[model samples]
Target: MQIKADSVEEYLAKVPEERKGAFARLRKTIIENLPSGFKECINYGMVGYVIPKSIYPDGYHCDPSLPLPFMSIANQKNFLALYHSGIYADEKLLKWFQQEYPKHVKTKLDMGKSCIRFKNVKNIPYELIAALCQKMSPEDFIAIYETNLQKK
Candidate 1:
């Protein structure tokens, strides 16, 4: 489930062996499509891709010491989870993901405003996931996050 690890490598090591393959594949996709300025680290006990303070200075709005998060992927107890904060904050992006997920993922998607839970990890729609990863830049994500903060 929510295993604690200080680094991405440790987090991967802690994941159950059976799920490692799926995690590895997903991790590869995340790396392959992740935006240039986003750095990968372990956050919230999961793999998090973030825009570090070096680029965004202000860091994460929730915690200034941490980087601004773009996305995260985790191996849960009974399922895997992928979170897209950018998509959740934008209606059009969220709609696109909602529309495409069903077409790509053969299994029923268990999704929320920001989180996509995959109980059947092996068949995740990686192509869609990669596209989602590539949809925005760190700067764009920062702009959106700041805009949303203004609304609240």
Candidate 2:
């Protein structure tokens, strides 16, 4: 399901035409609501918002050459997927999202930790996703990341 694309536009072009709009909407929502200091780029073969090396010199622990990831979206084989560290790293945020999902989303919440899957356009929880995107600024994310590393 991973297609290597040089840019976000290139990645979007590779998506199935029927799913393009949903992915685009998802991407737009992330970018629009993304907190300051996170930059959008192609990471892990998907559209990603990350902390640039200029800000986080250590880079991603998994791949230091790449920037630290915060959020990302991609069109998968059967469903569009969203990955969010803000939701994954924070139990409170995850719980709040779970509690609010039924209030805002009519579709079943098919997710694993931070990965939220959407099979239909109407089922995409834009508000919930945006709220997560806005919950943490780059500074907040860095602080959490550093704290986690210390505990390890």
Candidate 3:
């Protein structure tokens, strides 16, 4: 679902009524456990956590005007989607998350390169997401981004 909102509150308001609670809790869990230096804002039409320009002035490599996006949560048409850049860029982190997912949710993991899809909102596994949020910091993300940048 494409939610055209300018703020996190606005985005939350647009979510389906059935998903409001789960989505809110998911957002809260991320915000609460998110490491220092990442800021929350509406990014790419979702609730995004990013390293602001003040911290990384170069901004996103794709779009210098926008902050470097670390993570984003979207209330998709069929499920809630979490896009974490760290997992997409860091192999160890990706493997760790993949291995840890089964312990948190009984259902088989449904994931993409960077997007983790939660088809059942009740089984969202907020705690695992919290742990994932705490796993990387802004500096760590930037270093990985730069390292990959060099490879490219």
Best prediction by lDDT: 3
lDDT of 1 at 25: 95
After superposition, candidate 3 runs with Cα above 4 Å error: none
Identify the superior model by lDDT, candidate 1 or candidate 3: 3
Best by TM-score: 3
| Predicted candidate 3 versus true structure: per-residue lDDT over 1-152, tens digit per residue | 78999988899899999999999999999999999999999999999999999999999999999999999999888999999999999999999999999999999999999999999998898999999999999999999999999999
User: What are the per-residue Cα lDDT tens digits for candidate 1 across 6-36?
Assistant: 9998999898988899999999998999879
Give per-residue CA lDDT, model 2, range 17-115, as digits (tens). Answer: 888888888888888998789999998888889999999999999889889999888878778899988787878888988999998887789998889
lDDT of 3 at 139: 96
Backbone clashes under 3 angstroms, per model: 0, 0, 0
lDDT of 1 at 23: 92
Model 3, residue 98: displacement in angstroms? 0.6
lDDT of each: 0.89, 0.86, 0.95
Each model's TM-score?
Answer: 0.96, 0.95, 0.98
